[model samples]
Target: MSRSTSTPAAPATPTTPATHGPVRIGAQARTAQRPTVDPVVSGGFWYDRRRTVARVAIPQGPGLLESAGNLHDLRLAAGAADGPFRGDYPFMDSDVYKWLEAASWQLGQAPDGEHGAAAEASLAEHMEKIIALVADAQQPDGYLNSWFQSGKGDGPFLDLRWGHELYCAGHLIQAAVAHHRATGADSLLQVARRFADHIDATFGTPDSGKPVDGIDGHPEVETALVELYRETGERRYLDLAGYFVDRFGHGRLGGERYCQDRVPLRQADNVEGHAVRQLYLLAAAADLATETGDDELGAAAARLWHAMVATKTHLTGGVGAHHDEEDFGDPYELPNERAYCETCAAIASIQFSWRMALLTGQARYSDLIERTLFNGFLAGMSLDGERWLYVNPLQVRDGHTDTGDDQSARRTRWFRCACCPPNVMRLLASLEHYVSASDGSGLHLHQYVSGRYRGETDRGLPIFVNVNTDYPWQGRITVTVEECPDMPWTLSLRIPQWCRDYTLSVDGVPSARTQNEAPAQDGWLRVERVWTAGDALVLDLDLPVRLVEADPRVDAVRGCVAIERGPLVYCVEQVDHPGGGLDDVVLDPSRPLSAKDRPDLLGGVVTVVGAGYRRRLAPSGWWPYQDRTDAERGDHASPVGTGEPVELTAVPYYAWANREDGSMRVWLPTD
Candidate 1:
């Protein structure tokens, strides 16, 4: 399991399927053709460059990488032959292995010293140590896992629903693939294959005499197996992956008792259930369709994407409606106060959206990613980037303190299951991968952050893009293109869904075209003249304050509304109004809210000021159903609510909890 510093071997060529199996309900069976890797995974801006720079700016930067690197080093320290896992925390130990594997694949894609050789070595050592631990704990039948292995005598596979046996296997398979790809080593791959083969042999066959339940409590294995099939080109792996997907909604898989069981996978109208698990399953299904050429599966994924965006999604592109269930609420039932936007869910949603964008060539998918990245994803980490918010609520009640019982529904330093911290670190460390993508014909500019990109277009033309702009804070983006080949190539600039109006400029010439303009003649802006290094394009999107109200169906807020600018949802904190309750808050949509730049606040957030009323106690006289009530209850007074005019300020919901520990609410009742 321990990997050497030597370079990894070339990726193995995919094999042709000798025999074919019947396609299960949701399964995409492989034929004779070999499966290819997703272009998104193979080529993208590296994560280390795009996400890590911002991450290291936070307070916990040292511990973030230290923990991850330590985990990685432990594996390498243990030879591929044998070593101990050597970690006090079992969950962290497991995650360290996962990160090592993911990091390995990234390193293999572009092995350079920029990522730090020492860091890489440490990761390899940790991986090796964990593999040795796995080997020592593995059962004779090829089952491997420390937690499950230890509990075998009393109850082996007794609680597959919550135990996460398959989930661990999925991570193992992922790490194995990543390490093999990065180091060209087979020791870990061999171990992964044995475990995978055992899983395929143990689960899901009418004749195997094992349980026929096709679903996993955690939906990761489906995606992992699909990746394995892509890497190995083995038909069996693809079949098994498909089987998991198909078995997902059928009664044979024990129905949707856990999550999403009420409806079949293909028939499910929206993204629901555990936030992370649902998105992972969707991503895997998308990969399966691409790998197996299953049009039906692809259509299902597309429908799900649209449904999520249209109904379940927030203005910031965050999903997962209710904090209580950590699941989807009724369509358009988005309540800011009760919103439980888990950090992991946002990451998974972005992954799923990115995959969809790749498959369909739609800018909307990328648009969603941009929204989530700027808002929901950004909210996951504190301004300093050290502390993390497990649950990102749309609204925080002013003066309200969260009790420990609702930790999952609030932000915290750490959790008993501290998966998000490291996960956030790794994601941030590798954010560059999500920026722009090339399809050979043209380059797709998904996000508008200031940066430079050098990559080959799908047509193999060397393309260089240097973008300069202040994004999220400002809407101006200047993109310079160079190295155009003899043949004309198109460049697709994403027009964000939120951008009601935008101006386009080519080579410094302002075009009259706006968002309403017709699609470019060639399905892309045509630059007939031979392009030079200085060729430039400028885009300006209007980022203005916009009022947002929840659907009438959401019972939590019958007559309330929230505000948003760009992708951030705004909230009114009690700190802004010392004694005035949010209930006294009301927005006069007619009176436009002004946006003022306040750099003094977290990350230069935009503040919106408006006129509203402050609630005050009022005296009331008792009334009776009959006309004589005034005399019968003479001089009797009761407390009644009254409002006084006041000025209110609102900040982004993501920035609320970062300020003074006071209550905040997103939705304010209007009188």
Candidate 2:
């Protein structure tokens, strides 16, 4: 079924005509039109974090990249400085580009307080310096890769298997687009277009004069080219994106598993190979599906999404189970201690799911976005926003070794091949984009972050809705209409899957609809009425602590249950448990769980308290495999030997390891 841009009740929203900071692609299609509120306009949790990124994270990124030799490589390539390339990885250029991208977004935001001006000025200075260095490094033909520029590689695009030429170019284009949108300076965009033109001239079939039919070892350029297309309104950039997606699965690069080209993308059902690469490919394919209106591609994306959620995902919303290959294992192969759920992979999942939500306006897609944002993606960075984790394990065993960058036992200041830190910085800087979306009829509240919404109705009438609430901690959201058309319009609020009971009222009158059977449009409570200034809509979502269990097929966590309250996933860290390791803890479902505001701890989180049991250790030095029916005679022993009643305290999973790094477990064995 082709997704017609036209809506049933309202006209389709036009493509973004003005250059904006956070451009939501495919808004004109059936998907919701994403109108991001300025970071200055939003307050509370998200606003505070955005301010931290602008003040600390963005400023700190360049120094880390400089220490890691990414900035040095660029200057060496540009002949502005003299030194041998200092980085071990060929993809170091991407780190610089990502940091620049973060800086660009930071520069673009309007500051809400006295600290805003100084931070924006600093970001502007950094953006200019990086842009100058990057432009100087570019070849006359628009080729720019610090690795290739430093003469470390034979030539440009020579080794698609290991060389990240296209990957670097992709990041460069993204940074350029962001810089252009933020500052309206055409310099970076012009440089990017030149490099993109060079790519177009060098790759593709003979008839197009760029006769190279191969895909990148990494999948990013496809999405970047599409973004460039959106910026320039050029047809060729979209074509190039399509070409890259079509060229996969031909065994041209590495066969199926290593590069995710094993089977043709349109025919493949499950996500395979490197988790980050697979997700980027699918995300770009989703962009292609909408841009070209290809139903087959759309269906393929849907299938891969279903496969991932059903079999490959963890309770914490992370992916990739095996550490050795940084690849996903067989179905239901998720493990806790040995998980390789790279922080980059989690961010990639968010990117893909966001695109999916914007493409179809499906509540489930936004559902995944909410799951990922609070758990997987947020867990990548520390509360202070300086430290980062490459791998987020659900269970951290006692005495676990810190495996160098790839699978660290705890968050690190920087990694050898650092990708997650800058990536996290960029995501947090642009988080306002994911708060809410404007469907043709009205606004749909996706994630319940406190923010403002500004957009237009189908008839091009101005609409502004001011939202105030503390979400994910308290479930009460109050939205007041500030401006809107006089005609009847709908306001849709997501009924989060975890919200079993909720109350909604417009102008202090209770909704006639009753529990569980209220009609919803795509999982949202749709309220349509004639508009008026100062109209208030109040929603109270039940926020209760619950114990969730995984499917029986998930062998690693068969009898274990995870604690959750609202959008936050809860975990028990060693600091919270005075008695023993978290591995031996078992939760009792019959006992009630209570939530408390911990203002003094972990940057102000609502901690969950519950009754549980701790395993009592049997006497050691008996036998290798002995039964413990009686202490005198040993035959066999049960995994859950004996339990002692205890009171347990759990903190948000993302807030763990900030105080101390000890045993932590999200899924506890249920007694």
TM-score winner? 2
lDDT of 1 by residue, 1-671 (tens): 11112222223222112222222223433221111221222222222222232323322433453454433333333332234433333334346445555455444433335444555465556556655655555566766655433322234456655556677677778777766765778777777788788888878767758664456677777777876876677778888888887776665435653455556677776777777778888887776766666667777888888888888887666788766667877777876656877787888888788766665556677778877877787677665555677777766664455766424445566554555665665455445556666555556677665555543434567767667765666778787875556556666677766566677888778865555553443123333334567889888778888776666766777777777787667778777887655644565555668888886776566798877766442343373333446434443321222356667798876676677666677776664
Instruction: Indicate the TM-score of model 1.
Output: 0.78
Model 2 per-residue lDDT tens digits across residues 91-147 = 999998889888877666665355667766776777788888889989899998888
Give Cα distance to truth, residue 425, candidate 1, Å: 2.6
Taking all chains together, each candidate's TM-score versus the true structure is 0.78, 0.93
Where in model 2 is the C-alpha error above 4 Å?
1-41, 517-521, 619-624, 627-642
Model 1 residue-pair collision total? 36
- Highest lDDT against the true fold, candidate: 2
Backbone clashes in model 2, listed as residue pairs: 256-262, 627-635, 627-636
Q: What lDDT would each prediction earn against the true structure?
A: 0.61, 0.79
